[model samples]
Target: MTDPNQSVLSKLPNNVIDEILIRLPFRDAVCTSILSKEWRKHWCRLPQLTLDSDFWKSKKDLTGDKRATSNFTMTIHNIITRHSGPLTKFTLCIQYWEIYPPIDNLLYFLSRNRIQHLVLKLPRQFKLPPSFFTCLHLRHLFLQNCLLLPPPDFKGFDRLIRLELHEVTISSKLLESLISNCLLLEQLVLRISDTLSDIIEINAPMLKSCDFTGDMTTICLKCVPRLTELSLRYYRKDWKEFDVANFLTSNFFESCPDHLEHLHLDYGVIAKGQEIPKKLPFDLLCVKHLCMCIYLDRDEILCPLSLIRSFPFLQYLEIQMEHNFKKNMPALECLEMEAFPDVIFEHLREVTLIEANASIREMQLIKLLLAMSPALVKMVISPHRFLGKSTIVKTLTKLAEFECAPKAEIFLKLV
Candidate 1:
């Protein structure tokens, strides 16, 4: 029997249906419009527009030409014009095929609508449409592989909150202008070419999270008071040698709190093994939550243990070890332990270890847990890829048997 609620639910307004469809992939939602007359016109008015080549086909049945790129562009323009509302999002992804025409007209249309989120992925070079400078409401922007011909000016998006660039090239002046103009930006990610200096000029006063990825490493922070979270991944060398001291020497976190509540740094160091940086003068006295993904060889220095102890108020810690360390690696006994067991926090609550290779090598962690003054509320242990279930269970049983505080629980998974 059909439920009475089903009929009521079906009576809901078409606008609500359009809202739901906007969140789905552009191709799938657009095709649903053909199923019913009521659905056909609503899709054209969706605030979010996503165009991807994967949904298009070359066939005599659908269109005379399989590669009708012009038709696709025209269809997109019609959708925007019919929608008659400020667009919230516009994403265009073009992959593999190179038959596409210039996208300047599309960008201009999107900019004119003052889209809040925009993502464009293209293969070749293209100039930013003149209308791009007027997109003042844009909050999130992502551009990949679209080589900016003259390197468009950054003054375009004044309210951009988040920006991501991958495999793109930009001049330092443009980069500086972009950062300076997005004064309210909270998160920023940069992955670019090596020729471009690994530099970031952050003038955002309300900036909070920052991630600098790739081999390129130089970064300069000018005036960011509210900034807290920072992530540095795949750097060429230690970022400590940079002018962090100069940036903070006058006053560390003066505009923000004395302590950062969370920090993530996945970077390479000068040491051969998983060694911690030599007792650096810089201090993160207020960090409370930390997630670290660091790469270290079997015999490298063990820096994570010491690093955690430095955070006086640390309550939660998550560590993801590199996968390469688990294969044909040397014994853990061969490494140093001076900094290992002493790093457990006095107020620590949860500790999670991802991709741990050897159970024997994990004894150092067990020793650290046993030495903790505070009750470690929860612990997660994930064994290496090759570790057997029986071995992991036995190892966990042994570790769990060790003396622990009143509120401690251990979790283990073998992968």
Candidate 2:
């Protein structure tokens, strides 16, 4: 008879056991070594390791001593040194300690082991070493709060598919060279950076999605034929400093390829007396989804209407209303319904209004869209959170009474 003490995991094949160990978290995987002789040292050979600082913080809390910090640093050094096989993925978020030697060694080891995906959230003012850029096998890279200066002999990571930089300091020319060299890059995200003051021109041919949020003098999209989705949210406080009118009308959209489908624009916290152009530079005849967040005065309610006319094939629309006291003051202006263009939304189907207030101008805008979109199927209205039930009821009644497409369905969602 077989010994009943034999564990079920021990009976499994070595390859199958390795697969199970790899799925466990780094801490738990290492702890599994105490279970039996067969499981010992198995975690050391795993291909992926995530060295997050939060893990060490919890250990420090348990030990109730400051020495845990040094031990944490040593623990990471030992893991990198003892590991035998290639490390395909590594995520290091250094939040507690400022030690650089061990971290540099870790990066060197990962570079030699052919790491594929690396995420580094380093401390403030920390500069990434040149060896970090030499990881040719990297497919996804995310760096936050660090300085990025490529080496003189830098050839880009050709295999990189997705790259994200948040609060990183790098020159415009260096950034352009980096993107130009990534032949396989498909997605890129750039958050606010203090050092970025010059124009940003993206010429990635294979790029599919791009998200940019910052204050730049100008943004140029060139040679990006495959780009479909683009989101731009400019820094709010410095909106007046930027040339909003020139940026909107300066062939920015005309340079983009025609296949663009989704667009999101948020002009945050516009002050009073700022003029927003009623006309957009490029016609978005192919766009199917559009989202706009603006702070427009009563007179400028026609701005969104003008945008609607540009997209004849828009199927879904989402609008976010920003409250501006100066803009919200009651005012009356005769809306010339006939003067507006008689464009038909042939493929338009759905519209969603968030934080919608039942203003007269808003109602008129809704009525115009409803009259134009014969193919509309549904409209969802979500009131602001602070609105009372009675106000919501009134808003819903107003929408229901409004004349729309014969078959269009209306939905009122209260928050």
Candidate 3:
């Protein structure tokens, strides 16, 4: 005779049971086998399976015998062989990849089962198997510490909506072709480790956002008409003097979408000298939020200032400054020299200055913004972590005298 409580749980809708099991951790879902024989079937029918590092840790804790833990490959084989339902989402973040063979068979199994969302973060970098491309229905993909060498006849991820590649290796041609063919892709994130020597062209027309952090030869926004937000964090390995302040990477913005609204950059040493162009060819009239890192150590101040001049309609500005102790830099040179032209910021409202020490460069930048943005609303000055209270006091005294808009409020925040 069945227990009364067991009868009620077993009577629950099959879809409801699968929903509960998929939401639980992989170990917890497997352990539900002890609940009842019916629950065992529900666990095996879960639509989403995530066997990550935490799953192994949980098993070790439960047994209190880490040495006798089950083999990962065998465990996965058993689960896949016993599963009775199609899996739509699968994630495997594991260590010790060298001990196992290629995962071609596992990926093939998932491909046949209609897997749509996949994340694989392994211990070492390995080329993805041919079976990886067989999962043609994938909508979202995340890969780390791997190499992408798709088969020669491969088409592309036609249904993919998002792709994230972290510490992955892919040739320039492959990366461009992979993205261009993903016609529906909307978001992209690339935290690359490889030094890309060839230009990466992004032609994703439907793409809306991109955040890339790596040094590349250059990039071209070939056909990104819908892109709105762009973020780049790059530092060239060789900072030798160049004709342009941005190491010739400024051409990437030549195709900036007229609808782009937010821009964030962290490239350092933009200018080696004060000979930067007085004005760029284009203006980012649509951009309202601008965040950039400027280095005063190399006198990179003028290049950034010139770029900001192009944002005639900017609303919010955040500057993360990098300054080193340089004895040769003048202490009190006004920014109003012939190269620096003054313009009233018609739409500028809020400004944030990070890593502020009372250096002449920082003080003058603050004063320049105060005098320029007649429509300014508020300004926040966050001093360097090691800045002394005496220095802060002196800075505050100097700031109190700067001329600003009547409605503008300045605040000094120290943390």
Candidate 4:
């Protein structure tokens, strides 16, 4: 972003002063207008404006009173109207119902002057004005609690590189259309409502990272070969009918970049004695780091073990456990690897087992890990709570008996 007025502040002909003032809080920057006529002129030419609820809340009384809101709206109107030059970044997170008409007018005004980065967090699902989408130069857009009604002739924001939609009501078709047009898109974050019934399809070839909060099975990925990072906020349940084949055969992981590095999700998609298939639906041979959240039921380690087998080149693995199943379920007397005889962590280096109890089942896993992973370097076992010191000694003694491959160091964290 260039200085708004070259002749106004050309004394030193440097952007040092301009950046300092513009980067300040919007209220503090605006207050400079009261300093002098020259300062007021400088402010009117500000190229970027960011306003939120905190600006008006400074007044102690009647925070949301009608008169207070009126003054706030009028003040904003005056500031924007008086401002000159194109706005490169404009953010408004104020949740005032009275600002709908004012906001529409303001967006229309800014659109003509080339607003590139826009963020709007409304009080409710306010339908965006048509002028909002006409800002074609936008590179980044963040919208929350708004109804997205793209204009009929809407070609997407072609230059948009990043997009975030938090609880915004938008049709699945529009979302796909808008994403497909963003040829330069790299990151996408979505926190959509469950009411959006249609299956969401992602076809962005340039996309690299995605943070999503919804059912893992609902989204289908296509042609996204560059995606290297994926994080899901999933609340899992005892999925009786959810077959492992669904995930193994799903293109969600099949279309991932060859070097996919990070995977985070909470879904116990396997049982204690599930069958292992000959061929998987997806390839994870390039995965270097993997994190999984699983429910520990009846000392079932296969829930996580099955997924780890796919990452042939895995270097870092973290298993986050939850006691979502029967708490009193007895642990197996010893760990057994007869079921996974062909699986090995050849390139595995570090392993972290969080929220672990030193039950026979968990200890067996630790023993198996020590005997396997030849390249293992560090192992961290974080207990959910404190166990007596004797329990630690006994566990270590048991591990000492296991014939291991790598001389990996171990740490016990009582957290």
In terms of TM-score, which candidate is strongest?
A: 2
Better of 1 and 4 by lDDT: 4
- lDDT per residue as tens, model 3, 40-155: 76777788889876686754433324332335656768777888777999998754443334477789989999889999986566778999999999999999888788888999
**Which ranges of candidate 2 are over 4 A from the true structure?**
1-6, 12-24, 59-69, 95-102, 236-241, 269-271, 296-299, 324-344, 357-368, 385-390, 413-415
Alpha carbon deviation, residue 293, candidate 2 (Å): 0.8
Predict model 3's lDDT versus the native: 0.80
Candidates, ranked, lDDT? 3, 2, 4, 1
Candidate 4 segments exceeding 4 Å error: 1-14, 34-46, 56-68, 95-102, 235-245, 268-282, 297-301, 323-329, 332-335, 352-368, 380-407, 411-415
Q: What TM-score, computed on C-alpha atoms, does each candidate reach?
A: 0.80, 0.85, 0.82, 0.78
- Model 1 stretches astray by more than 4 angstroms: 1-11, 53-68, 124-127, 149-154, 193-195, 236-259, 269-276, 294-296, 325-344, 413-415
Residues 1-415, candidate 1: write the lDDT tens digits.
7556555545769777877887777778877766555567666777888876545545421332344566666766776567676678988776444554556666677778878898877554544555556667889988877555332354446688898877666676677777787877888888754455646656777788877775423455677677777766554323432232233233323333553577775644333432344323355677777888634453433555444555667788888867464444444552334444444467888888888764445655555555573667888877777777787767767886677667887778645
Worst 10 residues of 4 by lDDT: 234-243
Off by over 4 Å in 3: 1-24, 35-38, 58-70, 95-101, 236-251, 269-271, 323-341, 355-360, 381-401, 411-415
| Model 2 TM-score, all chains together | 0.85
Superposition error at 27 for model 2 (Å): 2.6
Record all residue pairs in model 4 with backbone atoms less than 3 Å apart, i.e. clashing.
Answer: 248-281
Lowest lDDT block of 10, candidate 3: 61-70
User: How high a TM-score does candidate 4 get?
Assistant: 0.78
